[model samples]
Target chain A: MYAFNYHKPATVAEAATLAGKHADGKLLAGGMTLLPTMKQRLASPSDIIDLSKLGDLRGIEVKDGVVTIKALTRHVTVANSAEVKKAIPALAELAGMIGDPAVRNRGTIGGSVANNDPAADYPAACLALGATIHTNKRSIPADDFFVGLFETALGEGEIITSISFPVPDKANYQKFRNPASRYAIVGVFVAKKGADVSVAVTGAGDSGVFRQKDFEAALKSNFSAAALDGKSQSAAGLNSDIHADAEYRAHLIGVMAKRAVAAAK
Target chain B: MPTVSMTVNGKPVTGEVDSRTLLVQFLRETLRMTGTHVGCDTSQCGCCVVHIDGDAVKSCTTLALSCEGAKVTTIEGLANGDQLHPMQEAFRENHGLQCGFCTPGMIMTAVELVGRKGHNLDEKTIREELEGNLCRCTGYHNIVKAIAAGAQAMGAKA
Candidate 1:
């Protein structure tokens, strides 16, 4: 890791202001990724702004059919929160089922989404569950938030305040985890809100979390496992790796989508 | 180098560390708490696991300077002189280790699990909770068994 100045902010505004002062400052949320990268000499910033002390950026709240998580809240906290479980059980279950007890306890949702790793689990929830990304600057729609692999609409030095997930009528997540990292090889999140259906696929896409129109269309017609008998997602525009080829992952997309639908119902 | 002060285990320890210093490095090199080993360097292995304010976290992935005024506990703090923590005792009796490379982290993780959910003991639940921790020893069978025993003992005491 490279030498840099460290500052812990008591408030979000102070953190953002400090971020703007430094040329190559990085936000330290959970350090699940940032610290590792620094160790590998992957990145050497001039300043490190630690966000853990910001009391406002932690907690779970449910109000008027929306589940809001402050950026600093860990996966385990969300997974165990009564309000989160009551409002979005699928989301809570997903949180409980992240990398493991260690990762779930330390890795923050904001850090995962902000980093926008192609294989992360939270992006699927954000995209499929119709979440709104609240930043220190503005709120971005889930679709508009993720720009590409490890990419997002967030500008340099921009701090994500919180994420608000709209409670859908039903939602579920299924992932083919990497044997080692346990990150998604291909994960899907399916949601239904009244007549509207949104299906987001993570892990298998190079362009980041994606909306599968075909599965949405199938589920709209009939929301059942039997309803997706011959449904298959195309291999085109998907990620291929040593664990699985795009063609194989594309098959998993359909299979997991079917299971996710069944689980949701 | 930046000077930082924090409570480690139960003692207030202060040191002058580089701004780039990792929390794992501080614990091992500065404080001589060598029990927290650095594994994989990519945060994959839970070898460097420790407690920061009662939350289990990978110390390798945290900056030492960032822990100012915070309370941290490592594997070294788990036992008193000649008395083993319940988790340690369970692992010993159950033969929970082979290479022992992952024991510190495994114990730390099991401690958190029992803290979160009492020792009910199920294979699937233990398997899921131990996911991020990769033990090449194939010693997971005994590790799970030990965790179950540890959970039972700890819960009974609580």
Candidate 2:
């Protein structure tokens, strides 16, 4: 890692000020992604504003059919959170499946969502559950929050404060992970609330995480894995890498979606 | 340069270090605690695993500044002086290691696993939980067996 100044702020306002002061300042949430990128010399910020000391950005609260997870809450916390498990077990399960125990101990949900890694698992749940991303400035719906691979709608110096997820009546997430890196080769999250249904696919989209409206519509009527029988999204515009081809990813999206639907309670 | 201070294995250590210095570097270089090895500088290998505030985290990926005032426990702190920790003994008795390169990290990870899940972990859970720690030497058969026994031994401790 290159030489850089590190600033630990006790408050959100202090963090914002520090971030604005430095020309190439980066906010360090969990540093799970940023640190590795820096170690490889892929990125070198002039200043790093550490948010781990900011107490305001850490907690889990569930109320009125919604679960609010603070941006700085670690992945391990979310996975072990009794409130999250009761309100949205699928979200907890997704959190548990990320990386491993060590990574989960340090990785944060906000960092994962903000980085918008195409292979990440949180964006699928955030989109499928119709969650809202609350920043220091304003709240953005999950659908509009993620722009593309390694991108989000967050403006300069806009720190994510928390994310609000509406507890679905039934939801489940399924992922086909790359054994080496443990990143999702293709993952699906399925959720149903009353007549509304959502099916989101991650790790397989060329434009990043996306929803399958057709599958959602079908599941809304039938509400079962059988509902998605003979259904498959187009292989076009999906990610193709050495690990998996676009066509195979597209096929796995359907397979994971069906499995998620079958697993959904 | 930045000053970093933390309680390592019960001793309060303070040092001046680079802002980008990793926790493993602080332990190995400044403090001369070489028990924590850096197997694969990338976070994938768990050779640098340590307890940061009682949780297993990769020291290589963690910044030294992030652990300010946090309690850290490394492989060297696992036992009493001259007496091996239960997990260490379990590894030896079970022939858990071949090269002994990944032993420190494996034991540290096992301690945290036992701390969280207790000694009654099932075989599938043990194999699944050890995903982060890679052992290329023993094929993981004896290591898994060692962890099971170590967990039981830790459970018997006060």
Candidate 3:
């Protein structure tokens, strides 16, 4: 990693101010992704504004029918949170399935969502569950949050404070993961609330996590695995890498979506 | 340069290090505690696993500055005087290692796993939980057995 100044801000206001002061500053949430990227010389920020000291941005709270996860809450906390499990077991399961136990211990939901890794699991859940991301400056819905691969709607010096997820009647996430890195090669999150259904696909789309309108419509009519029979996603505009071809990823999206629907509570 | 102070193996130590210094570097180089090996600096391999604030985390990925005032336990701290930790003993009795390169991390991860998953661990749970810790030698069959036996031994001791 390159030489850089690190600042541990005591509050969100201070952190944001420090971020604004440094033109080439990066907010260190969990540093799960940022650190690795820096180690490889992929990213070299002039300053790192560490948010670890921000005590207010580290918790999980459930109020009414919404689950609010603080920005700095580790993945392990979310996976083991009773409130999250009771309100949305699928979200808990998704959190548990990320990277591994050690990674879960350090990785944060805010970091994962902010980085907007296409192969990440949280984006799929956020998009499918219709989550709202609360930033220090303003709140952005999950639909408008993720813009592209490794990109989000967050502006310079903007820090995510928390994310609010509505409790779905039935929701589940299924992913075909890469065995080595455990990143999702193809992940599908299915969510149903009353008559509305949302299906989000990650690790497959070239433009990052996106909603499957066709699948959502099909499942809205019949909320079951059988409803997806013969329905297929187009291979176009999908990610094709050494791990999987675009066609294979498109096919896996359907397969995983069906499995998620079947397994969803 | 930044000054980082933390409790390592119950010892309060302070060091002047660069902001980019990793926790593993602080332990292995700064403090000369080489038990926490860095098999893979990319964080995929668990050779750098250690307990930071009683939670198992990859030392390679953790910044020393970030761990300010935290309690860190490495492989060297798992035993009492001359007696080895239960997990270490179980690994020895079960022949869990071949090259001994991944032993320290394997033991640390196992100890934390037992603390979280309880004393009774099945083969599948052990295998799944050992995802971050990679053992290229011994085919991991013996390691799995060692972890299971170690959990049981820990339960008995408790």
Candidate 4:
């Protein structure tokens, strides 16, 4: 990795200021993605503003039926949090299924969502559970937060503070993971709140994560794994890689969605 | 250059290193604690696993500067002089290693796993937790057995 200035700001204001000061400054959370990317020479930031010192950005809180997770909270914390498990076990399960126990120990939800890796697990949870991405500047709905692959609605120097997920009546996330990398080959998160239902697909989208309207509609009528019977996901615009072809991914989407629905509590 | 001070294996050590230096490099080169191996630098292989602040992490991917003032425990720290840690002893008794290249990391990860899950670990759970630690040798049969035995020994020893 290239040597650059490193600053551990204790406050969000200081972090934002430091980020705005340097043109190529990057905010360092867990450095799970950023460090490896930098090591591979895929990214070269002029400065690294470490947010690990920001104590306020590391926690989990549930209030008014919504679970709010601080951006810097590690995946292990989320996976083991009783509050998260009670409020949204699917989110906890998703967190637990990330890279591995070691990676979960270091990787942060904020880093995962901010990086917006097409195959990342958190994006599916965010979109399916109707999460609200709260930045230092404003709040953006999950639907609008993710723009494209490796992209988000975050503006320059806009730091994500926390993500607020509404506790769904029933929700579950299932993934067909790539054995080697543990990345989602095809992940589906299904959530139903009263009459409203949302189905989000990740790792199989050409434009990154997206809501499956037809599946959501099907679940809205009958919330069950069998509801997806004979329902098909179009292969158009889905991701095709060495791991899985677009058509196969489209098939896995149906399989995972049904599993997610069956597994939802 | 960054000056990082930390407690390694109960010894307070300090070093001046490049900001880009990985924790494994600091341990293997500066401190000469080579037990923490770097099998695959890409963070996929668990040969560089060590306990930072009591959590097992990949030292190859973790920045040395980030571990300032943290407590680090490598495979070398697992034993008390001639007395082997229960996990290490279990590995030996069970013939858990073949090449011995992945033993340090495997032991480190297993030690932490036992700490978190305790000695009553099922085979599936043990296998799942051992995902990070890879071994080209042993086919993981004896390693899994060693972890279960180690966890029991740890419980009995405690």
Interface RMSD, all candidates in order, equals: 1.4, 0.6, 0.5, 0.9
Instruction: Flag the better candidate by lDDT, 1 or 4.
Output: 4
Greater TM-score among 1 and 4 belongs to 4
Specify the poorest-scoring 10-residue window by lDDT in model 4 chain A.
A1-10
* Runs in model 3 lying further than 4 Å from the true structure: none
**Model 2 lDDT, residue B86, Cα:** 93
> Which lDDT tens digits does candidate 1 get at residues A108-219?
9999999998888999999999999999999999989999978899986589999999999998888888878778998989999999888999999878889999889888
Which candidate model has the greater lDDT, 1 or 2? 2
lDDT of each: 0.88, 0.93, 0.95, 0.93
True contacts kept of 3: 0.80
Residue B17 displacement (Å), model 4: 1.2
Arranged by lDDT, best first:
3, 4, 2, 1
Assess every candidate by TM-score: 0.96, 0.98, 0.99, 0.98
Model 1 scores a C-alpha lDDT of 0.88
Number of the predicted model whose DockQ against the real structure is largest:
2
lDDT digits (tens) for residues A1-265 of candidate 3: 9999999999999998999999898999888899999999999999999899898999999999999999999999999999999999999999999998999999999999999999999999999999999999999999999999899999977899999999999999998999999999999999999999999999999989999999999999999999999999999999999999999999999999999999999
| DockQ for all candidate structures vs. native | 0.79, 0.91, 0.89, 0.76
10 residues in a row with least lDDT, candidate 2 chain B: B149-158
Q: Select the stronger candidate by DockQ from 1 and 2.
A: 2
lDDT of 3 by residue, B1-158 (tens): 78999999999999999999999999999999999998988889899999999999999998999999999999999999999889999999999999999899899999999999999999999999999998888999999999999999999998
Per-residue accuracy of model 4 over B1-158 as CA lDDT, tens digit each: 77989999999999998888889999999999999998978788899999998999999888888888899999999998999999999999999999999999999999999989998888899999989889998999999999999999999999
